[model samples]
Target chain A: MDIDLILKAINITVIGYIIVFVVLFLLYLSFYYLAKLLESQAKERCRRAGKNKCAEHDKFSVDSDTTAAIAMALYLHFGETHDIDSTKLTMKRESKRYTPWNSKIYNVIHRL
Target chain B: MEGLYRFLEYTGFANFTFGHGIMIIVGLVFIFLAIKKDYEPLLLVPIGFGIILGNIPFIQNAGLNLGVYENGSVLRYLYFGVLSGVYPPLIFLGIGAMTDFSTLISNPKLMLLGAAAQLGIFATFLGSIFLGFNLNEAGAIGIIGGADGPTAIFLASKLANGSNGNLNLIGPIAIAAYSYMALVPVIQPPIMRLLTTKKERVIRMKPPRSVSKVEKIIFPVAGLLLTGFISPASLPLLGMLFFGNLLKESMVTERLAETARKPMIDIVTILLGLTVGASTQADIFLTKQSVLIFILGALSFMVATAGGILFAKFMNLFLSNENKINPLIGSAGVSAVPDSARVSQLEGLKYDKNNHLLMHAMAPNVAGVIGSAIAAGILMSFLL
Candidate 1:
């Protein structure tokens, strides 16, 4: 192997890994700050919306424990015997419906 | 009798070779895997059928224009999208529209795992070079570790575009990437098991906070600007991805989002898969280099899986016991998307039921997509 080629490959690998980590790390910082800012804004909005509305706003931030509890409650309520629907609506025509235009007597008689 | 003899000369029986027979069986195997095993059927089926279509022996240079490589062929025209790096970004648009970034937004630290898994990409670059491939071919081959078929195809198209007397590796690389991606369930778990302890696998992370609509709307624009500036070479792909995401998040462009994620994506996937598969003509595709590429691809995937798991464990050293993340979710750092995450979920369940890691695993899974594209950009800038 050429010495220059090996060095070039090493250089590319180090630089490539660094750039990927840095870009994603920067995204992490941005999202972290964005979440903080959003949380504060939500708090302020709730403060203006009165105590009742503030309580409702809090529901969106449920902890994992509460979520698990809610899930358990729902599971207990519904059990496992729910109806299975494929959500597909298939129309099966047993036979062609009798229509005035298609009636045998009308066609044969030529009533008009 | 003379006319009949002329007709027989043009028949497939006259034209068939051992290579065609082998390639046809390979095609049938792909179709079987897709239909029976349910392994990325959406891709495998089209590719499988295309392989059969492409390998149907015909007289060479007969002005038939039937082969994918032949000029004026319909398959060749469709292949232009892949060769020119057009189809991957369009597929990215659909991925963006369908993807929900809330999990990532709620917990950003997981993005590092996505970055960590890219170790496989870089590592494979060195490996390919050591194996005697040129810089550009190595770079194209390295992306298979990213476990993202589109990124692999895109980078291979650009870096190994077959210009300047280089080998046209787009077909082999694409097939390798997609094949490994479909086998994520098979490839990742063993590595995941090898790396993590039962206690680590059973660790349950907290549920994500619900993101506000405003934050959701702002993320795509911010993402586009940030990643776009850092790796402009990736803009063609990242730009479309974020644009499709913006259309989805904006709420006003629901119709456009629907179209992007649904019908448009489906059409492009069919074209990309079929053309890519058809590009694997017996004479062009089966080579010693193709075998080497497959080996390197599998090694890269394993390295990527280990990198994610190890990185998660390293992060755990800094985190408090209560805040520790499941190391199995680390495997989701490879850019296979929901599949890697699903593996995490399944593996986690094996250790402890009622511990749903899907939502948490998604953070890294989606970030891996962004990370791989950035890596592709960096490689393109350097190697191209």
Candidate 2:
């Protein structure tokens, strides 16, 4: 039962928890304000351009599947090749072997 | 006959001990659980095989240089990454590349749940001290509560890696952290159910506002500066994480992001898992302290889960009914990533079909990752 060691441990834990919370809280505030600033900036840009539908565009989003599908359609429409295969090809020779049904000798024996 | 006797002395049967037999069975159980139960198979399989490899008894004091602890052994050389605290940062880089911060950026207040869950780490520190562990050992052991394996290993390697008379505890701490992370589905649901009312579990949150591309690009850079300024010791980890995210968000570095998230991460994970598993030699790993670490780890998880769940409920008092959060997602604040998030979704489905909480849960889940890294930095500053 070391009292000094216990005191040190308690001090560290309290201070550690406070620091973690403060740092995260600060992060939260920064992000909250950043989001607000970005929103206002977008609004200003929309007003200057004389467009009423800027918020509408911001609200619109495409999921990954739709994006992929659109990309594929564009690729096909443009007639671009996605895959490039090597022009050089190598071939190997194969020897034919006889099966019971295919063999001439077997057919002759059956006829006899 | 004499030559035959000499050969017999070199055999596995001649060198085998009871400890080796127990460890071998433990390895087998890990493999079986991975194959049959589908519990973190990618990590557990490599670790399980490494365990069996390490526990294969060899002749003692023979300069064979075959074991992981032996000088010039291949496994030992690979293990230098873990010992020197290199692998965790690389793992963070991969995580950052793959993770989408849209949910978190759109809903920042959920970050509080992530911060609250860190109560487990501090609570475990106090518990460890009461149990007579020194400050350094207690600090290293406490991070098991983060429910993130790499962070735990990173902290342990720095604080308790058998240097300066500190107990080397990286192996047990890593095993405990990963084990609890894998068991998130089992561990978290019960606590979530216990903490929240049935009505609270079924509450639907407002859909997150779509994050703009510019916001995504700016987030990592801003995050890096904010967190790095607060805890510079965390730069190695936070810097790599933000850099990986920037590579993904920059749109021009897609190839680099793809490589970092896919192949590079996979190779590092294999090396980290195998070396960590092999480091658990029977003589060093099987001890009273190891058992205490496991117990404390489980307690840490429970406390962390409770802390998140309670904090969510506490926040509900301040919000309007439309903005009320489903407390079940609070359990995702422990940083097990999508596993804990999935638990929230599944539990939500049980109460009401078509109630999807996965997206909402992910906000706190990712936040927990950052929060734990920051917590690790704090511990390092104080204890180290």
Candidate 3:
């Protein structure tokens, strides 16, 4: 009913709205940085663990595609199934070609 | 026919009213949400049952009281515990024990976001005032923006009634705040997606460095001192919160921490929920103003989310890194605990599977609890 009062309300609401945006922005930035740090650390850990020439070459070629497939399978079967022992058995049966290094990678993915 | 009429009269079946019927249904819905939906079940179930009991007609004098007095009812007695602000803060002591401040200490910058998210409270406060609510009423209403039920109750009890007074706004406010909080997953995502693109959402974050034990111990104590200096009214809440955190970090009192986190929080939640629900009788709840309270409460949540997202966009100006933040986590700054953080994680995962935003978002999520309490205390001091 009062134009000045309505305008003031709008102003306050706008300011309040802006404040929320700023906070979210900061949180996003913090998470983004945190994730990058974790990824780098994981990569470094992988590099250090794979000091041998054979392991280093395999690690590089594992590729994003293989990682995705492994991740999907692990999450769908292992995570959703909720039977860790059974999932491990299934993984061993399905991926008989899995190396000790592959198991290590699986462990890392499962942790995530 | 005469016998049938006498039976009906004795049974009081003819005395049932529309209000009683409506309240019964409302109580049933609360029960359903509590039991079936598992929505804050510990509190909601008792509160729901209490509401049903309070609303049943002709049951007011069922030998429940010593004598009929002008202001005494079984519901009123239970409601007084809520009105006096007794249950909510004691509940906070338990919450303090349950909460781990390490997430916050590991990432202190998120505290700013927590503070930023509280724009919702102040905005809603001013909005309620314009909506023709007096300062105390506006403060009570605005706390819904904080999205913390205990803080809302504490502030409402203080502002609406100092030592002993009857102000009927706390029930609706608490209900609205908790309801919205539970709905964080439903409420936060669309806003987050609309504001940020896939590029931003997929932005990878570096994992936090391990925080030193010294930093963890100093954090809660320093936080209390700093926040208390700024707003003394916030000391009780901030003090309890930091104390709980200190107990967890100190690691010497595992038993005390366990007590604070589990049975203690559980017991208080039941009492608080029932007391709140019992306070919401049909006579009080069936008002146009109550409906408006819910609407305003939702608006507050939306505004709070928007504020966080926009602020993130603004921050983009100062920094240049490959890992820009996904603004969605800003919504976690509203004190819903882990729910809003979970929502942020889900949204981030949608863009990039590797984006584990939960632990990171937790920093602001917990900080938002402190921020809202501070804001509430400020409101109480000024208004009361």
CA lDDT scores, all candidates in order: 0.92, 0.87, 0.71
After superposing candidate 1, which stretches have Cα over 4 Å from the reference?
A: A62-112
Each candidate's DockQ score against the native complex? 0.47, 0.31, 0.07
Model 2 CA deviation exceeding 4 Å by range: A58-112
**Candidates 2 and 3 compared by TM-score, better number:** 2
Model 2 chain B poorest 10 in a row by lDDT: B59-68
Q: Over the full model, what C-alpha lDDT does candidate 1 score relative to the true structure?
A: 0.92
Model 1 captures what fraction of native contacts?
Answer: 0.74
Residue by residue across A1-112, what tens digits does model 3's lDDT show?
6677566555544554454344334444554465456556666776777757435543443333454467679888866665445444333456444578789877766664
Question: Chain A vs. true chain A, TM-score per candidate?
Answer: 0.53, 0.52, 0.44
Between prediction 1 and prediction 2, which has the larger TM-score? 1
**Model 1 Cα lDDT, one tens digit per residue, B224-244:** 999999999999888999999
Q: TM-scores for all candidates?
A: 0.90, 0.89, 0.75
Instruction: State the lDDT of candidate 3 residue by residue for B1-384, as single tens digits.
Output: 999986665453565678878878988998898789877666668768767765655533545441112157655666666777777766777777777666675556666667777877888887787777666777788888888888988888777643334356876788788778877778888888888877777766545445556666766676666667666887777778878878777889889888887888787777777767666667677778678888889988988887677766666556567435557777888888878888888888877776677776887788888878877767766666
The docking category that best describes candidate 1 is acceptable
DockQ, model 3, C-alpha based:
0.07
In model 3, where do residues sit more than 4 Å from their true spots? A1-112, B1-15, B59-75, B161-167
